[model samples]
Target chain A: MRKIFVCLLVFAVVLSSVALAASSIEVWQIHSPIPEIMNAFDWAAQEFEAETGIKVNMVRIPTEDLHTKLVVSISAGQYPDLLIWNIRPGLEFQGLGVVEEVSSVIDEVGRDNFPTATLTMFQAPLGKQWEIPLFARLAGYHYWKDWLLDAGLDPNPTVLDDGSMVVNAYNTWDDVLETSKKLTKDLSGDGTIDQYGAGFQYNRKGFGDSAAYAFSVITTFGGHLFDSQTGEVVINSPQTVAAYQFMKDIYKSGVMPPGVVAWDGYDNNKYFMDRTVGFIVNSNSVISNVRENDPELADKIGVTIAPAHPETGLRTYSGSPDTMTIFKTDNTDSAKEFAKFLLKANTQVEMFKIMGVGYYGPLLLNVMADPFFSEIGEQERMFVENNKYFVGPEYPGVPSPELITVALAVYNGFVYDDALTRISVDDWSPEDAVKEIEKRVLEMLEER
Target chain B: MENHGGPRLTMMQKETRLGALLLMPAIIVMLIVIAYPFIYSIIISFLRWHAVYPDHPWVGFTNYIKVITDSRFPITLRNTAIYALVGTAGKMIIGMILALILNKQFWGRGVVRGLFILPWIIPMVSAATTWRWMFAEDGVVNFLLQRLNIISQPIIFLGDKQWALAAVLVVGIWKGYPLFMTMILAGLQNIPGELYEAAEVDGANGLQKFFYITIPSLRYVLITAIILSVIWTFNAFNVVWLMTKGGPSNSTHILNTLAYEYGFVGMRYDYAAALAVMTLAILAVFLYFFAKLQKVEE
Candidate 1:
């Protein structure tokens, strides 16, 4: 009897050990194509596992498949314990109520750790934090300094300490157009124009870059797709028409490459990197690519805030930051712990150092003061200074759950891009395109 | 009745029982994989099922009505029809010509046949990506056309609304003709050279022999090929989705890509489901008529 008791007791301990071993949490993150960025996440996961006895299983999903995968997983009642994605879709997930309210996580991480502007973008429906801001992705104009110098344009335009470019002929939209014409040339004298002055994707099928740039143009022109206070569909204003006209003018000016209407998210980067185009509105991915692959070209590349409105001198920079959220799972506590771990200043600094400053800007304010950021490059300074101008898709509107629906319309090629394509490719008048945009926005709003 | 442990069964009954037992696993799998999803999709089509929203209130027929009334629906449907019909027709014509040529005695016929199947053998995504580059404004297509003086200026093949669908169709035909060619070639081999020789002895010309004996012998094969090609071209999502993504003002959108846009991008699962059901219905009607025609032909 004593032998039997001993064996049962031993079995109980073994079973408990097995149970403890199984207490790992799963996290689904959109896979970055860059190896170092992915390795940084793996390192963080390993560190988290080392710190806590609980293991972290990091599942990397491609960006295109992530959204549908999340929806299917959640609907099938097999969602991960944690998810990291863009703040817009993160808010949409929160609005769906599958995510845990991470206000407590933010409190635990310390609300003051993150920048207020960046943090505010994630706090949908107000007074509640749905996700923790991971990193900021800021958009700007990436131009070749050598090309500018060759064209007799300012290689280094005066930027205010506040991160806004001083409005001048060199920085305004019209001035940029004039500069583009000067830079647009046939260096080979092959009886064909081998280079374009400027280019940005107007393709409706692009992954939100087109919409982001178009929205920046619209916002700079003093227009709002939705009223900030009322959340009404207001994309039919004269300013929107002017913005559409400006985009059409750019496409029609022979400055952009032929078929700008069909370029995808990567086309601008390809064009800029291959020296086919002198200037483009894009995120820092271009810089990161050049810095890693073509250092010579990287030295010649100049990063600045996107062009200001030729008339109003208003410059709006579209920002889509990566964010982390804890889903409502049995492993909520472990997920929350991992989120806090990711939000740590040292962890972020280490990760960003490996990821390179060109890929992501710091989310935590304290991390910005780290030597890693300070010594990075001039472009890093531009990224940090331009953070003040970072605005979500809900730029004119207050960030809310409704903003997700509005932003989805923009992201899904239903609104801004559709309007741009109508005016540029389909030959619809800007006013008519804006009217159709208004109608579509209203329909989507109604459905939402 | 036998006095065994239980009531004894007759031979037919035993055979029937064994047959059912053998089929049980397959039936269960079919139920799980096929029937459940089909029924679930049909049910979801009747509801308002946005992936993000919590409430999926049943608005019977509203989703379908909305799908029909949506402005993009007509355009997508028209585009799908043109893509299916024109793409299949092009594939059949090209495949028939190639199969006929390769059927004749020629040096390196085997090598030529192998080369013709390369497009079909290559993965669709890789082919689509390569074709996208080749169709670029400054790509090889324009370069070649300009060199030949066929056109003075470069045509943005995949970017122009007027040419996007046609470009997609060209890729579809190129990728698909191999299957038809192989099928028709097999059918040609089975035609028994005696028929062609008899037609020739009867003072029939080459076209006459082809039209009378060859075509008549290949009717079933051609019909089967056409049906398969139509289904494939109609449901083709990857090529169009990867190439243009139904862009240049959604000119290249087929039903499949549009359904993807609605379901995945727009998050309107109900509308997407409705579009899917409607597509199935349209294909079902076409197949039903095709079946009737096949019966009449028989």
Candidate 2:
């Protein structure tokens, strides 16, 4: 009896030791395809592992392929312990129960330190936080100073020391359109214009940029994508139709380059970098790229809030909030600990400082007090101010999985951009294009 | 120990058993790699499944019905048909012409052939990207056209809905025709010199010799090449995805890209599987007909 008891004790001890040794967590992160961002995550994982005595496995997926890969991984029953992606898909994943409720983690990290908007956005359906904000992307307009001046126009509409802008020069869509036409010039008596006025990428390719651009336009024109509560299609509203018409007129006006219809998300950035276009509405990456490659050109760059609709006097922009979601895992305790560590204000601020304004801005308001925003230049300030109003298509903001589904549908299907292109390139009437989109969006919502 | 060099079996039977044993590993590998996934996809096609959902309910043919009833289905089907038919026909015609030209006795025929093979040799993604840049509004094609006064305005080759597929087709032909050219050239080389010489002695023209000897000799090769090219072009994902991404209005979406959108972007795995199953069926039917035709001709 004594020998048997000793044997059983040894066996139990061995099993416990093995279980403790196997304690580990795997994370899949999709961020900007930059070494600094990747290295930052690597550093964080190393530090976490060293401090907590847990193994950390980190995998980097390209941003464009993140949605597909995430879906596939979950479908194949290989769920990562954590997934970092944009905020757009959080609700979808949460609805499917792939995401763990991070409320306790949020409390542990001090909920007051994070932004209220982000907190409110994540807490839904079951009053559980599905995703935690990592960083935020604010989309606005960046323009070329030299080109604007050469076109006999003032580039700086409003400049603020607090990283804000209130543009007076191109206040409305009409002003923007007219300015673009003027900036487009025929040099050397050649029939082909040397530079285009505006670069609008209408190609429906990448992660929702085209749809975001369309949403910015439509919302400014007083159009909403869906009745957020009912999930009814509101894409064919008068304001939406008018926005399409405006886009069509711009496409036909010859201010945009001929290949604007084929341009993907990066094309506009490339055009701006090449000095081939006078104006483009994008994140501050354009300015950041110039600052890196050509500091002189960077000085000649201007930043502003995106232009408002000509009639409604409303301005809007689209945001892709960088978020971290913990997947339901066997190592739930380890996963929660990691989330808390990552969201600690100092840790996040360190990451943001390393990434710089080109990659990310502080999602939490308190992180702004961490000297990251205090030492910013003019371009960074512009982005800081723009984040105040940037929201997704389900704006005037009711966050729901159904709303995100509608937005993703329009985005994935390229519905709005397609309508704009049909009107612009194929000579379809705006009404007809809007009608087609309405039908498609409604069908998608119904099917879901 | 069981049967020490026993001659219980006939020699033919022993050889057959040895052959079967030799093929066992390959058969098992095929079953594991190909057959399992193929059967799994077919099974999943009959269910309503979201990747993240816990339950994948068996919906009978409901998934198939949903796929067929999708408004984008008919358009995608039409686009696939156009892409395959046009790409296959164009590649074959261009391949034949190049083969005929290169089959002649020429001083630098080998060098010319090497130059023509560059498109095929270069990677598809790289070639597609280069073509995309070339077809851009301010690209070299437009630049040259503008310099020569061909058009007053630049053309958006990949942007316009009506022309996007055509632009993709041009790139497809550029990348694919070289394979057909090489195959047909080999076929042309195999044609009997005696038949050609006899036809020439009968005062047959170049066209007549091509019609009488070259084409008939190359018929099998042409059919096989066409069938292969059709299969490849129909399932092509990278070129179209890179160049247009089935965009400007979803006008260029083919089966593969559409499947990707549904499965990945939309997260509707069942619908994507159903669509894929249908695409495979369509290709299988075509292969059956084409293979039968080849057999009949033989």
Candidate 3:
């Protein structure tokens, strides 16, 4: 009996030492609707573990619930070691002082590898980098090519030298309105309109597709929610009112679906996919989804930059970059190592190839030269070219911590969406809606 | 009764000690889980607390003041009152009617009762999602209405601001009536048949019997059900949130959803806490009357 007890003790000691030698890091990633993208993360984790002997535990939270879950987890002192999120929440997390600065990781990964615009956007207010930039999503208008052709319009437009598309028939807001009128048809001759010409999400749910589209329109119309230079509340400007008026005109003109006012972020994508609408402004996720699920529909889709304001001659597109941040935790070193691994050019290219071209734009300039990008389809090429005009959430204003805070305030409060809702649904004058929005934005900024 | 001891403990004292020992764990759990958070939320309500910021300075009643004076406050308050009152009334009426019908000697009564209880049995998220889809422009609801020749154009039930709240109320009433139905059904069963027979002997009609005998016997159950229904309806966030998200022009925002917007989206924890405390206070006043009603019944 004594001999058996001693042998068991030795075995226990060996097992304890082995357990102590092992290291694992937990990653809380926003859940991707696409299975390939999700599986890519798992594949990367397995590869990392094989190379480094450090296990990666990935927890997927739905995109809508990520922020709330993170906040609650942070308060409970149970946050993950690394958090992967889109661009907007990173600054808010940094401001909350829950993220660790990762400048060293970026340096180790080679700073020159990433695009200057993508790199600098994450480095805000304080010159410290809080997140490692991964992939970017550039927003543009996606249209049904066949529908455009059926309306006697040019199905294939010319791409300018500056990366802007020139579809003369729908190149400007007024042109879009007229083209939409032509595209809104009763296909079955049942007196009930079957296809809406335009699709825009006007719901005030949160910072979603609606807010992004509204911001693009506001910026294109030469309006800034805040003064670009001084960061003062300027939402009540004539330009802002004009943007709201245009949205209201589109809604009232019977071009957009009547239910557009209540749509969530993904509704427009569904409408576009189902061919219920002729055109929609969205990220490439819609096309990616189509390519995966409905390849026939994917072939007929066309992509271009959003319409330019005829008078201002300005067109703005929004860019949301996927980023990873290390939380202030005991496993910061392991998390940083994993983040650096994701930044490696080969790893990024592999993930991008798996997700497809237009779904995610390259963060690293070197990845742009890869054969995958060269052999991409026409729509994918246009999506990549449109990145030249892609701007951050603080479009008119510079990307600073102060301005990002105000932008987040406007976004989180759904100011633009509310203003649009007032004009379109409640029948408030654009000026009145803008003024109410200005008041709300000012209050939010004051709270900040 | 041992002579060696200076004094002997009483049996009552020993039982009391045992009872206290048994109750200690539950008391500690309540203190930790319920009391702590409740008090913490009340404390935060008096401070300027943004979740993203580090410093939380005390601002006294300023947060409460802002909540009251904010432009959206009145709108949210009115929406909440409408949702709570109308929702409760609708549920109670529907529940009472269903219970009255099911109480009679009817055909396939068990199956009918089971079918009526489905809205309650179905998960709230699933029910809300189904209802939202049903209320969509091109959904079955519109198709049915259009096919029945009720209207030429399909009603954008969840999209139009004018109809959004009504649509939400319809779902709320549908999901909630079962609880009251079950409670009132149980109450009806418990009542002695002698009272109804006595009413019949006195030549009291059906409506008279219902009002004079049935209502009074089920008075306590009805009051309890109303209180519970009102509280549940007022605090309902899932149906409204999942269906409309307090939207189509912020036309459907109740206090709970607005507080969620302030707390989670806006990161204005102080404003959210104040809104929560105010909701608690309003419910407390309602519960006070309910307690009084219970006492009178007792």
Candidate 4:
């Protein structure tokens, strides 16, 4: 039994080595189990190998389990050459030593080449040039313009030589709500509204982005989660308090469906694709998901920026930048070369070609400006144009995120009637949540 | 002295040496497998480590304070306690009843006994996965209820906080009952039929016979089963994690899940360690109760 086991192990190793061969440098690209993910890796590998002498071997892990595997392996002195995760880039892996410092490469790549706002996301804390920008998203929804045009709203708002009132994109949150309310109606006479105006993710997983969305609304009312200089939670401040109260008022107004607080992030996408929900904040890449299953919606679907907050006009969009960190391994030279290669404009643009479109746009001024790409990236281009002065939000410390998640869950909690959802949320007033968040941040600041 | 055809041997010394040698490997395996993690955990419970780096900085009583004071701490402790109490009491009662039913001589009794143990033989991961599927919005559980005309709407079992923990309990009972059933069944089988016959001759009713004879015989096995279940149930991370991820919101979070979140996901290793220590302290209290029960049973 022992001999057979050893023999099998040896045989497996030989097979792997023979398949790999000697001249090719193996690039382990970490991604999700989704087929699109494999295509992304395979395309990158095939392209890179065609252009250069390297073989990229892609390892797929379920997105949820990837973080644990990365940490465990990295801590044990084994790390992949590059990693692209399902999570937003900064929150999961960037701040930790696990991500390589990408500053030098960014300098080489040139600051002018990259988007200034995109650069802000990598500023100290989440900053440092560890990740070569792959793609990024603006947190919002997709609407079927074809459906809207059929509803008497023009399909394309932007006019050609001939004048026409078309389905133009929303520039602000109010615009989204108004559009949804207009679009929403009962198709059936059952009295239960089959089509609803909008929904927000307030449940367990979706609650992660609640802080960004809420405070952005507050920013619309001119509120912020923290005082940039004083390091305080300002949820009690008049602007934020008004923002919080207005959200409660919105729920009461019934612009959204029942049980908004219990909805997960993916639920909104599901609702929108089914044409049951008129609007939602979701992953921009879900346009493909809609297109894949509902081809009809693909034609009608128009991608655009979320509605700006009515007052402050802060287009607060949450994004997860797909990042690649080259670790110090036995092959550090190759790692550096690959990191630099990944930052190349051609390579970055190649990612869009291979990975598909709509989830994220390139974080480069040069790439965004290409006339050839002008027709491909429509909404992301608008997101960039809309948030020209955008700065990536940073967590104050470790518990800052937890406190924020708890607080957002609290904000979401007001909408949920169930005790289960409520308990996950800290049912504190914005004041209480702010107070607890301040305390938690202080603890994190003191922690090593 | 040696054994036959070898060296002439005195049986006593040879038997003693052979027993010691054979047991040594088991002792080493136990120490490596069990003691190492426990000791490592105890050390970590006092120290802080970066999730990215393994070298931990010791922060003696701080982690303990954090665990005890955090708002979620009390709730998790309460949930774990409720789970243990409801779980233990449910298993003991159900298991004892099954043992009684199986004790009766009948045709197909062997097959019946084997069938009762199926849930126990199931892989925890596979079992949890199936339970999750059954609990899904359009899954089997709601279908069954709808089929029976018990409810009109499909209840979100893991998605609702009130029903979420109850769902976990339902799965836990199903997973745990067979253990007690098997243990007590063995204990029940050990008693001579003559004792039961004598009890019948004494004109004792069935309830009286159960109280005096069956209960007394099963006490040791019962205590052993209960203590083991408590330990297993307390640290059972996969089932709850895979099911609800301790949500509707953090409604289903216990210390074990919280520790993983902080240490691994949240990157607050010191805080997680502190929580581990508290869980150990709580479990120690259970161990004491088990010891007392064992003494009583003896």
Candidate 5:
């Protein structure tokens, strides 16, 4: 009896030892303070752990504070096992060698699975193996199609039609101005305007949403900041001169609100949902939010293609890719394996569809092209299929994104100068704006 | 030998042991808290490191050189100087005047004293945010100014390059003056009434008493306050960063903001460490000169 008991105990000890031998994946994700997504992240980690017998940990920080926190912590030798950070910072992190390379995992994960929406980031700058893309974030207008018919610019053509609205696809700066002129009207027939055509922002800077969106309109007019490959800038080009000129013209034409320059999405969204503005240009996630926050507007709202390039039929919107980096390490084995798991087309589909409203588009081309993307409903398929190209602002003479950050800053700084604010719709020249942008950017670029 | 000194003291003289014993806990705490972080920061500054990264690289003085040559370097240094000089001087002047006023017995004296410290009591980031709201184009301050017919148009205080630094400096003075007032009040309370009594007995006037007695007596406190204020203001990034982010075209960026940007925003730890190292070097020189000056006062 004693011998049998001892054998059973010994067997139990061996079993426990084997269980302890398997490792846990200690991952740290930079968290935004959204409750729904936080819950989703927790659930996903649990499921991943249950499936693999690996422990998954997530450390989150506030979105506003993550940039500085990651920098200081990483600098101080306190980097987490794994973290999700903005892609721009990923570049700097790469330079510091704090991230592990996971090229094999990317190769194995089947790059073909990631959506076309996020391919640019997965490629990484200069084609270096550092991080896999975790999410793709983009923004645009969630408009009121019914209102467009009422405003008299719908595809069905809201001509001589009262109590209905439609808006034109913003083509030339002149076309947008003319549409806005018609859109900004006093329905009550009072002296004051009851509605406005467009909205803009002079405040709320972070990740450059306000400025970048506004600048995209400038870009749609054929304005550019830098050369893509040369790492040189032509910021002071003629294209940019026209962009600002259009802004001034719109203001003078009394289409957008006089206070539009000081208003961020907070004010703009309010004006939009209040049915006081013809359109609002902001994040894609805003479509879901409008429905949730103001269902009335949701019923009235419809998504549309971003403004097209004046000459080319090319449509453009800012693409910000969120990456999942295997931080730099000498041990390529586990890191590569982990990255491969994340890169799978199945995983990309899971990332988009499983998460809340699919704010993150898949990095795999197949997933982006797939109908089952997390947040994209059948209603938004046209936008997804036809208009999901990723493009960052170009630096004029230098073809580098790094230089573009500087040029954008300079242009935004002088955008509202009262002295030279002579903007006109037809004069929305990308060449002129680029020339003005170059003078300021070259000094910043040449600084060090 | 005298009988009192007959027994040779053990453990490095009896009186010195008492003093060492009294200070032992304090010294130990300082070693654990101050000395350790200083050493850790020094070691970290040498290595190219990130906490989340699987590996941290080692880069030497390259970070230091990079910070100096950065375009924002001189601008940051210059901005820091402006904030320190103007902010500290403004606090000193306001504090000195307020301390003199409060020195006299008055109605609601205690209430007035506490009220003056309201700015200091509020959390810095919260205070800065409130200031941002106040300085906003359509905020209460502009409304009030417009009502008073002070200006025809609202000024974009935080959005303009030329005005951002001046506005940040003003906010610093408002947030920091209460602390200065408290210190000056303490200094004022310490001055003996007998000195004023004696001065009055000798037919010395109010200005004479102030220049001869009050000025000399508080000189040490004034120097200490100035030194401390300069250091505090120079290292300050919370208020200015929260308020303007050295923006309106990098107009308000100071040394600490640069350190944060390079380290965190730029994600260049080596560069950040270099900026921090330069900050330390500058502070060390200031401390050395200050110590020398303080020794003369003693």
Candidate 6:
């Protein structure tokens, strides 16, 4: 009896030892402050643990505050085992060598399944995969179809041969301005406007949103940000000056809402939801909110490609692929395995569809081809299509660490946005605004 | 060997040793929390290092030169001066007025005091958001102005470069005066009724009694409060950041917000540290004057 009891005790000790030997990884995700997203991550963690027998200490940080916190952590040598953030900071971390190379995982998972552009923007300087994109988002314009109809613009057109409906895209910036001017109206004939035309975020704040708007306009005007190889800021071009002039015209034309200079990221959302704005350029979160709260109004909404530069007839959109990177000091094996698990086509589709509204669109080719993406809804399909073709800063420029560093600096300083605001609100000449932006960009380039 | 020279007192010396031993933990904590970070930032101010980059080379006075020579540095300094002086003076004057009113026996004094503190107690983000909404063109302020027919068109208070700074400063004063009010109120309570009574007996009028008695008694508290408030207002970030974000062509940027822009946003940590060091140097100058005033009061 004593020998039997001793054998059982020995077996239990071995079992506990094996459990202790298993690897445990800590994941720091910046999707918290949203219960639905948090629940999705928590569920993913549980599933991962169940499948791999590896424990994940999932930590949640707010997205807005994550960059500073992550940098501080990295500086103190206390970065998380795995980090998921936007692609620009991932490049910064890659430059700093705080992130581990994950080329093997990409190759193992078959890199061909991911879009070339998505991978190109996130790849390291020396052609190493340091992070894997989990999702992507595009900046585009959404407008009320009824507002367009009220303004006598054909937002929805019928095919001549068949009665199939098609979205009439805004062909030029002038068209948008004209349409917006028409949309701004006094409903009560009291000489006070109850509704405004466009609702672009004009505030000189937020890291990416405001700057992204200005940069997209620059691209639309056929202005090159920097030479792909020379790393020189090329904003002094006629195209660039024209872009500033265009924005100035928009603001001066009184198409945008009054007091737009005070708008933040969420203000445009509020303006749209309040039914005070005819159009807004933002992510699909606006559409999702409208769908959830005002389904009737949501049906009247139409999605279109962003307006093109009148002269150049070009349009460029800004988007950053959302990626997860394994830090250098982490249990890289376990972290990579977990990252791969999250990147699985099925897992991504399920995770993206969380909370009865899909905000994040998948980046992988296989995931893009999935019927789930096609069957989710029309909004989902449009958002995915928009993101798939969106051109980030990496386009028309070399995806060098220097380019990213400068882009981040430019966005952070709000240099161009400030200059544009000076032109639009403060009555500075477009030439002067372009020159000042050029000077600031040059200084920033030299400093970085 | 008459140890009368220094008392040769091992007993007193032993007590001194024990006292220092008792203070060691507190001193260590202070060094860790305050001194270490301060010194580290000062050291970083001399290095040309990005925050996350491991290779930080010593740049000596180059960073300082870079920061000082930058054109925006002078503008930020001027803005900081304006913000600090205006904000401090506004808080002091308004707080004193409110404190005097609240000091008098009045109906619902407790509730009014509580209500005054509400602005200070509310979270800064919430307060800033509320103020921003109120200041919008189509918002409450515009609606009120239109109803009163003050102006034909709604004024974009936050969007106009001319009015943006004033708008932010107004919010700062609104959020800040409560601190001064409460402190001055406490100081006013501490003043003895005898002083006023004696002034009254001496045929002093209301204004004269206030000038002679209340002002003299509250001098110390006012000086301390002004010094603290100046430091705080100089470093205040949220009110401006939330309201205008140094917008409409950098019309509203103060030193702290610029440092944040350069540091966290631009990823130029070394430059940011240099800017911080410059701010500290400027504050030290103010602190010197304040210390002199404090000494005079003492």
Which candidate gets the maximum lDDT versus the true structure?
3
| Residue A143 shift from truth in candidate 4, angstroms | 4.1
* Residue range A206-324, candidate 2, lDDT tens digits: 34666777778888888887776665667788998888888888878988877777887778888878878877887766676677778898998877777877766677787667787
lDDT of each: 0.82, 0.79, 0.83, 0.62, 0.63, 0.77
Question: Candidate 5 local accuracy as lDDT?
Answer: 0.63
- DockQ of each model against the real complex? 0.66, 0.57, 0.65, 0.22, 0.14, 0.55
Residues A1-448, candidate 6: write the lDDT tens digits.
Answer: 9999999999999888765544688888776434666777778888899999888888877666787787778778898888876646667777777788877888888989887777777775757777787777544577788888776678763332333223454556787888888888889899888888887766575445667777778888887678778767787899888888888888888877866776776787788878898877776667666767778888887766656666765666776776888887637788888999998887776776674334566678887787776666655555554563466664576646767666665655577667767786778888898888888878776765
lDDT by residue (tens digit), candidate 3, B1-92:
45995677799988999999999999999999999999999999999998778889999999899889977789899999999999999999
DockQ, prediction 2: 0.57
TM-score of each: 0.94, 0.90, 0.93, 0.77, 0.73, 0.91
lDDT of 2 at B217: 84
By summed lDDT, the worst window of 10 consecutive residues in model 6 chain A runs over: A157-166
How does model 3 fare in lDDT? 0.83
Best by TM-score: 1
Chain A TM-score per model, please list them.
Answer: 0.91, 0.90, 0.91, 0.74, 0.75, 0.88
> By the DockQ metric, which is better: model 1 or model 6?
1
Candidate 2, lDDT over the whole model: 0.79
Tens-digit per-residue lDDT, B153-226, candidate 4: 77777766778889988888888899889888889999788888999999989899889998888877887888
Q: What value does the lDDT take at residue A176 in candidate 3?
A: 86
For model 3, the TM-score of its B chain against the native B chain is: 0.94
The sequence of per-residue lDDT tens digits that candidate 2 reaches over residues B1-298 is: 4877766898999899999999999999999999999999999898878664567888999989988987778988999998899998999999999998998999998899999989999998789878888988878988899889898787888887778899998998889999999999999888879998899899999899888888888888998898899899878988888898887677888999889878876677889899999999999999998888878877
User: Model 5 over residues B1-298: C-alpha lDDT tens digits?
Assistant: 5687567888768889899999999999999998987777777687765333445566676557667777778888999988889999999999889889988999999999888889889998789878876876667877798889897677667765667788898899998887778888899899999999999999999999999999888887888888889889878989887876666456788888877766554444556667777788888898899899889868
Name model 1 segments beyond 4 Å from true. A1-22, A157-170, B1-8, B105-108
- Arrange candidates by lDDT, highest first: which order? 3, 1, 2, 6, 5, 4
B298 Cα displacement, candidate 6 (Å): 5.6
* Model 1 Cα lDDT, one tens digit per residue, A286-310: 8777878878879888877667787
Q: What does candidate 4's lDDT look like per residue over A1-448, in tens digits?
A: 9999999999999987765543344454444323565675577677766766666666776545666676667656677766664243333344355556667777877877876555554444444454555555444445666556656665454632433212353555666556666766767974546677666644444444444455456556665555555556554567655655555555545556554554544556666777776656555556667667776666666655545566665554533466555665545455556656766767767776776555555667777665646666554544444333232333222224333333322333222222213323334455544444445545554553
- CA lDDT for candidate 6: 0.77
Which consecutive 10 residues in model 1 chain A have the weakest lDDT in total?
A161-170
